[model samples]
Target: MPEPLTIMAVHAHPDDEAIGTGGILARYADEGVRTILVTCTGGELGEIADPSMATPETLGEVRERELRRACTILDVAHLELLGYRDSGMAGAEANQDPRSFAAADLDSAAGRLVELVRRHRPRVLVTYDDDGFYGHPDHIKANRITVRAFASAGDSSAYPDQGLEPWAPDKLYYTAISRSAMATFAERLSAHGINPPMSNEDGDVPPFGTPDELVTTTIDVGSAVERKRQSLWAHATQMGSNVFFARLPPPLFNELFGRESFQLVESRVATSLPEDDLLAGLRGVPGGQRHSPAR
Candidate 1:
């Protein structure tokens, strides 16, 4: 039998998958593509929306439960964790923890990801950019490790000690939010009399998101928005039950969360710019037939 088409995403925390990549994960899984999520941190630093639900010491485990449920909702086939704690925000005291993803040695952290790459032999790999989507320390570290694994997983000369054959994925993409999209989301939030929740945990909201011109692909995930919202709801500790996001009307929710953008950082396969499908240009898609929803 032919190998099932596979795509893998590496994220910094439990809820990260739901926010940026949830639609793709759900959409691809619906198409019978194997979806894998590698969560690098335990999300121990995430705020507990309700104190009665968990304490400081137990937040990580609670978030894991949430992560599992979110994955099920998205139909992610595999969920892997590198077992590092959330490396709070930049310059925070949590950054000092040796087990925090940001503080872990790059080679060491990335080696763990390389092993997964070789094991899964996914055709496509995805992660955040060097900015970690909003300058989160753990996000940045996830980017660093993902970039490393993407480069080394296909090279036998790298990480040979792992005893797995090297496997190269055809494409590497960075999840991104175009400046225009961010502006639209902000406008919608204002219309609802809600503040833009761009703050990085307890840290100041640094200049966030990607420039519009830099975005190379936009996947319309309108079909999967319901799953995406439910997955986000699974992380209710970070996003409240009737929070600003959940409170948005369906049209607005679809307008804001209906699409996901990506930057084609590197690719072993060819594809047209402004692609509508992440699986475009791969063997099955035949020159990347557009899978994005019709506008």
Candidate 2:
């Protein structure tokens, strides 16, 4: 039998996996891919959206437990944490803390991710763009380290002492929220007399979305939308029931999120744009396949 394909998604915090890549992860796992999640921080500084669970002292532990449940819902094959502290929103005091992920040394943080890349040997890696989606400090730091690790993990001379052989992923993708999607949501919000999140009073586009032209892949995860929703709901402390995502009717929610977008930052395989599958053109490439590690 051919080896199963593998995909690794590197995220900044616990809830991030659900918000951005939940659909893809659940769909690929269902299709027999070895899905791995590498979370950069403990999300210690995240706000508790649930009023009843607002114990700041235990938020980290609660969020960790929520993440585990979410991983299970998404059928993630492996979960790893880089063990860094959460650097709160940009300009927050946590950003000044040495232990926070945003404050960590770039080389050191990337080295930790390199170890996991070598061990998993995934054919694809999914991470944030240079802007880190919404530009949160930890998100930007996660993107920095992940980009570095993607390049360094393939170079044998780099981090040679990590005890794992160098393994290069066939493709690197940035999770994207496309401008088209944002526009559609904006229209819906305006129709309902609600202020959209993507615009200011001046009617100018915000920095939160990627240009539609930049999106190279759009995976149809319609079938996995329910699972994705369940995964997001698992992080109860981070998301409230009435938030934007939760408030959207099921049909509209699926319409917006059912098709996830990504920018193919780098690829070693031959593939065309607007791809419907993340593993497009990779199945037949030499050295592009991977097997699940033995139990």
Candidate 3:
């Protein structure tokens, strides 16, 4: 087998990684691609919907352990946490904490990410869309800092102490949720007798979902769907009964579109939309050969 392509996913919290690209990660790993999960925080303030782990006292620690287990399930080649506090949701009290993610030192936070980029030298970088996948403050913050880091890390003048060797990621993607996906998911919810979250009623879906033209990158993680399930399960505190995923008819969904979808936000490779695969845009580059990394 050829050397696995290196990919890095930066997420605001432990569960975000699995929630956003668990399937993609599994698919890549199965194809011998080296995948790394960069979690910014332990998600110390996350909700514990799991009745079994509902105790307020143990939730943080439990969630942290769960994140590690999820990384294991995803076959992550490496896992690093930037050690910030969860900013909680939009207006939660946690956001008020001086050390909370919302209050995290942007320069310092970004410097940590710069170090990772310098070390891993990933060709592609992944993060939530500008809305931060739902405009969660922490998610937005992560997106902001990561984008800034991506732009600056490649410059020797920026944060030289973080290890000046610059490695510019060729492409940056925003993991998007589409209206079609929402419609499909709603149908699934009805079948399962589960009500959708109240916040979703406004139809205020983010723009990344249905791009004027989406470069569709499909990963057939048919075999890795089970791994995806375990990876999601690892975020037990957030997933609980796995309600969000239960909406999707597994393996079938995997066979259909698999675990990942991304829109090229910044790329030196390809400019056209509706890309069949992520690497499709980068096909001209030797390491960027068009190979479906998922199942």
Candidate 4:
């Protein structure tokens, strides 16, 4: 067998990883790929969806535990928190907190992430799009830091004292979910008597090259739907065991939501849009050809 591929997923909070790429991550781990999740905050500002554990004082710790459980389910090889506090939403008071993610020390934070990149040496990195996968301020910041860190991670002169030698990732992708997917999901949910909260009147997302860019790559994770469910269940404080997703039949979900989505943001190698696989653009790089490392 070939050497195990390494993957690092950077996100602003605990459940974000699983929600965004849990199924893909599960598939990667099942195939023996080395996957890591780097969360930027403790999610102190998160709300509790589980009424049983609904205590203001206990939610943060509970969510942390839940994140660990999810990680275990996904078979993540490594996990790290950037140690920043959740910034909450854009105008929230949490955004002004000195310890909030938005207020994090940029250079130092970048160095920390860069250190991880040097240590893991993943070939592919995944993060949110320019809109930050729904325009969350913290998510946007995470994307900015990840992009910046990727640039400096491989430069020996950037942070030599941090640890391992320099190593740059070969490709970077933006996690994307298109309007078509949402419409299809809405139809699926309707079949089960679940009307979507949002409608097409909310504003349809345009195709990739037409102006409003959507995803081009569709990564199928139908086989790993159960793993993704378990991972999502791990975020108990945010999503309880009896949530809407958990209540659904796995088979139905797998058919309707068979694939995870993403946009090819930047790649040194040649690639095309509307591709069927995330690993498609990753082949034929400086070293041996490899597909998308992990989720």
The global Cα lDDT (0 to 1) of model 3 is 0.72
Candidate 2 structure quality by residue, lDDT tens digits, 48-89: 886588587888888889999999999999999898999998
Residue range 1-295, candidate 3, lDDT tens digits: 4434678899998888875688778877776777888988778877777667857777767877888899889899899888788888899888889888788888888888988987876677889878787779999988988898777666777787764577676678878756676566555556565554432555342333545355355445556777777687677677645555545556544543454667777775654566645555543454432322232
**Candidate 2 displacement at residue 183 in angstroms:** 0.4
RMSD, one per candidate, in order: 6.0, 4.2, 5.7, 4.9
TM-score, model 4 to reference: 0.84
The 10 consecutive residues of candidate 4 with the worst lDDT sum are 203-212
Show where candidate 3 strays beyond 4 Å.
1-4, 50-54, 198-216, 241-259, 281-295
* Order of candidate numbers by TM-score, starting with the best: 2, 1, 4, 3
Best by TM-score: 2
Over the stretch 145-259, how does candidate 1's per-residue lDDT look in tens digits?
9898887887777898999987777788999998777777776777776667764554334556898888988888989998998898898788755466767776677678989
Which 10-residue window of candidate 2 scores lowest in summed lDDT?
A: 286-295
Worst 10 residues of 1 by lDDT: 286-295
Counting clashing residue pairs in each candidate, in order, gives 2, 0, 3, 0
- Enumerate residue pairs that collide in model 3: 214-274, 215-274, 215-275
Overall lDDT per candidate, in order of appearance: 0.85, 0.85, 0.72, 0.74
